[model samples]
Target chain A: MIMKKTLKFAFQKSLPVLFGYLFLGSAFGIMLQQEGYNFVWALFCSIFIYAGSGQFLLVSLLSGGATLYVTALMTLLINSRHIFYGLSFLDKFKKMRQMYPYMIFSLTDETYSVLCSCSAIGGIDENKALFFIALFDHLYWIAGSVLGSLMGQYLPFDFAGIEFSMTALFVVIFVEQWKSFKSHIPAVVGLVSATVFLLLLGANNFILPSLIVTVTVLMLCKNKVMEKVGGET
Target chain B: MAIDYKTAIAIIAVAAVCTFATRLFPFALFSKSETIPKSVQYLGKVLPPAVIATLVIYCLKDVNLSQFPSGIAELISIALVVGVHAWKKNTLLSIGLGTACYMILIRTVFA
Candidate 1:
């Protein structure tokens, strides 16, 4: 009974991720296959690398013959933002005990959102719900990737713009976060800094510099930004 | 287009390890401390929105405005996504419709 209840709640919580990951994961698989990697490679990357955007970026990096150090640096820069996610969940995760490492390992941006909004239901175990949500999401991603790789081997039509699903996913999340927040300074800072740096440094190299500038600016304005934004978040 | 199997595996391992380390860093550092520092708390609140906004920009980094077609398909599709989502507030519909629109535009018109 408890297992059934936890599974149901986890399904409900992870429904949003279901759509996003399947499509985006398939997109990654297709992209990888287009670069001549087989389905096994796609499965391995999704299962292990597991970072959505980083895995997408990884395809290009590998095909370009980037060294391991370079690949690691790029992955770090791309996923550095995850560090902030761990901070928010510090207290909640500490209670997880044995489940803590798995929770941290699977805390992608989408999972973080679902976990953040997870509330205790009358009959469901919160930790079990969190665990199941994480597990189901990871599986969906793997399923999508493997399916995409298999389809890529036989699809006759071009999927030229299919990757845009990723962009669309991020936009939806951005809008949702926008609605949730009272103050818009942090959002603006991120948008402007990234846009400016993208134009200055061009697409290939702007991310690191943009992240540095955004973090620096946010830190400098920490007092006022936090005061205005308050503790509502 | 193919990387050596050994090289490919090495790169994947590196990417996985690096990504995991970042996620694990905060818990490792602050899990024992009773109180997270004030600055860290403020950042925990504000960084998500900015990071997400930055991701949006990252996704669009390749849409060139100076070339022929000039990102028209991308612009129209993105606008459709934003419009449909703002109006209907449906995530799957917005993404599905927007992606289908882009696929058609690129294949039929831009082809």
Candidate 2:
């Protein structure tokens, strides 16, 4: 009965991620299928790599015949934000015993969002709830990828600009973060740096440079940025 | 278009390893220690807003402004997203409508 209740709670909390992942995960799978891989490959990538945006980029990287070293470096840079997520969870996760590994492995943006607010839910074992949330979210992603790849293989319709959903999702998050924060310096720095780098380096070679410059500039002005935001709040 | 089995496996393995490394870095470094450097904490707090903004621009990297349609499809769709989201503050609505708008524009109007 307790397990049933916990599972119910987990599903309710994961509803938002369920929608987002199914859409984005299937998009990744469809894009992979367009590049000539099958559902098996989609399943493998989703299960192993498990990062949605990184997996999307992986399709292009693989299609381009990028070297192993290049793939490693690019994936690391693209998913670098996960490192920060781990930092904030260190203490909470340590007490979760065996659940720590899976929790760490499944700390995607959506999962983190869900977990951050998880403390508010009363009358449940929080650690078990977290584990179930992580597990369900992972399964949802795998299911979406497999389904999308299968559909892409057999189904016939124009999906030409469907990829724009990824862009739209990012835009929504940017808007949300903009509204949440008092200081806009970091956002401005990111936007300006990326825009300038995109112009100078073109689409193919701008991410690394843009990221480097953004981080450098943010670090240099950390005190001022923090002071401004701190003053506001 | 299929990558060779060996190379494909290698790439997948490398990617999995790299991703796990990032997720595990802080835990491995600070597992026995309680202190997180001040600079690191500051970056943790501030980097997310900026990184997300960077990604938003990164997604638009391929848009061409000098062409005939220019970036009209992208611009129109994004404006709709922003407007809808600002009004409703609904995540799914903004993305679904913006994406649908983009798909329609590209297929019919832009084409």
Candidate 3:
């Protein structure tokens, strides 16, 4: 029963991201192959920096002769929001003894959705449940990356705009989240903060400021969220 | 054909260290039997949407708005994306359709 519930959650929750990862990961794989990297590099990237956007940025920085410190700092900046990803998962993964590390490592946005929605799944162990979802999504990316690298050996076609698949996927998630909620405070806060920050701080620094402002605003609105919590959870 | 072992090792080390550093935080910082601070939890609820907005605008950051046709192409594409998802409620369909439309719009209309 537990096994059945977790599988259903994994499939239902991660389907769109699986679609997104297949194309984007494959594209990244093919690029690495073309850059004279063997399958090992692609494999390692999937295993390690499983982040889609962060990995792409890292590749560019690496090839451009950016120093290690600079690459690390840029990666930290680009993925600083992940610190929040960690903070949120604190309670969720608290009891998973052996699988805790992997859970933390693979906790991307899509993975979080799959885990968060798993309360719908009856009989699943939180430990194994979230672990498998993370593992499955990571495998999707790995398989896609490997396929792209091997396909690169013979392909003469363009993979140009396919890179935008991540952006498109995010738009899809945005719409889904918008549809699911009556309160638009988070959505509005996100847009206004990101836009304002983009204008004030420049493109590179926008995410950090937007994140800080969004958190601040949400904290101020906590009383309202608590009311919702009292009503729902 | 030959590959440079030194370069491979360097890349591997860099990638490994970086990956480890990222995983170290949530695993280390938060697992001590307490809820995350209320403020952080609230922020997580709000942050993902904002990140999406940044990504959307970032795509347009390089465009020369003076090339009004290109700007029009981007705006239409963005609207088409939002509309497709709203109507069908399927992410794969929305993203795939949006990309196909944007590809054509950029190559032909903006060209």
Candidate 4:
């Protein structure tokens, strides 16, 4: 009975991840295939990079013959924010000694969201579940990459418009968070900060600056917001 | 027949090692302190909205906005998503439905 409930809860938690992995991963696969990297390359990149932005950026960088150091530097720049994310859960996860490495490796923006929100004691069992969820996503990306790479060689239809899925996913998350939260501080802070940084930094450099601004603003929003907001999550 | 086995193997092994090192470095390098520093916890609280916002704008950075219809469609979908999320407080339905609407607008009406 307890196992059944855990399964149900885990399913509910990971459903969004499932949707994201399949559609976005499939689309990314098509792109990789069109670029002439075979299925194995796709699988390897998806599993290792495991980051949507970094992987997408890596494809073009590799195609352009960028050096390994250059690619790694760019990847680090894009994903540095994850360092802050990893910090939050270290205390919660230190108990699972054997599982800690895989647990940390699988930490994506999506996985972090799910795991951070979970109220479970966050022991080895929860760590296992989170790892599996990430593994499931990793598999979807590999499968989609293979399908796209093989199919692209023969398929004629345009794969032009699929990148919108990422935006579509973002829109929904923004909306949901906005609606649920009582105070508009977080949403407003995000929108305003992004717009401002987009103006100041242009497209490429805006993220880090905007993140800094958002963090500065939110840190001052009162601690009770997180604790007493009931379902403001 | 077309597979470049050497390049493929190189990419896999190198990327795997590098990736593993990235994930493993923090756990191994850091002292075994269970109690997180206050600064990290503060970041944890501040980062959710900040990250969400970053992901959203990043995706739409190159959106073709010179044309009014696609532009309108984009804004409309964002608005619809916002509306549904605010009213129902449902993440899945809001995102799924909003994406469905976007796909339709782009493929059928805009096409």
TM-score, one value per model: 0.83, 0.78, 0.81, 0.79
Tens digit of per-residue lDDT, candidate 4, span B26-97: 455454665555655655554555566667776666555555573676777778877877788776777677
Candidate rank order under lDDT: 1, 2, 3, 4
Over A1-233, each residue of candidate 1 has an lDDT whose tens digit, in order, gives 98899889899778767866876888889899898888899999999889988998899998898998899898998888687678777877778899999999998978876665456798888888898999999999999898888886575766568777767766777777787787788989999999999999998788778877988999988777867787743
- Of 1 and 2, the candidate ahead on lDDT is 1
Model 3 spans > 4 angstroms off: A1-5, A64-66, A113-129, A224-233, B1-4, B33-35, B44-71
Better of 2 and 4 by lDDT: 2
Docking class of 3: acceptable
Q: In model 2, where do residues sit more than 4 Å from their true spots?
A: A1-24, A27-38, A53-74, A77-97, A108-137, A231-233, B1-10
Q: Give the TM-score of candidate 3.
A: 0.81
Candidate 3 residue pairs in clash (backbone atoms < 3 Å): none
- Model 3, residue A96: C-alpha shift (Å): 3.7
TM-score of 1: 0.83
Candidate 1 Cα misplacement greater than 4 A, ranges? A1-9, A27-38, A56-71, A113-125, A156-158, B1-8, B109-111
The lDDT leader among the candidates is: 1
lDDT of candidate 3 over B1-110, digit per residue (tens): 03354654465467556655665676576556465665666655555554555455655555564556746766676678899888887666877788777778767877
Residues A117-144, model 2: lDDT tens digits? 3553666777788889898999989988
Name the Cα RMSD for model 2: 4.0
- lDDT per residue as tens, model 4, A21-139: 66566666667766677677777777776777667776676556555576566766766656556655665557667767667777777776656545564332565565566566566
Deviation of model 1 at A111, angstroms: 3.4
As for DockQ, the candidate ahead, 2 or 4, is 2
DockQ of 1: 0.58
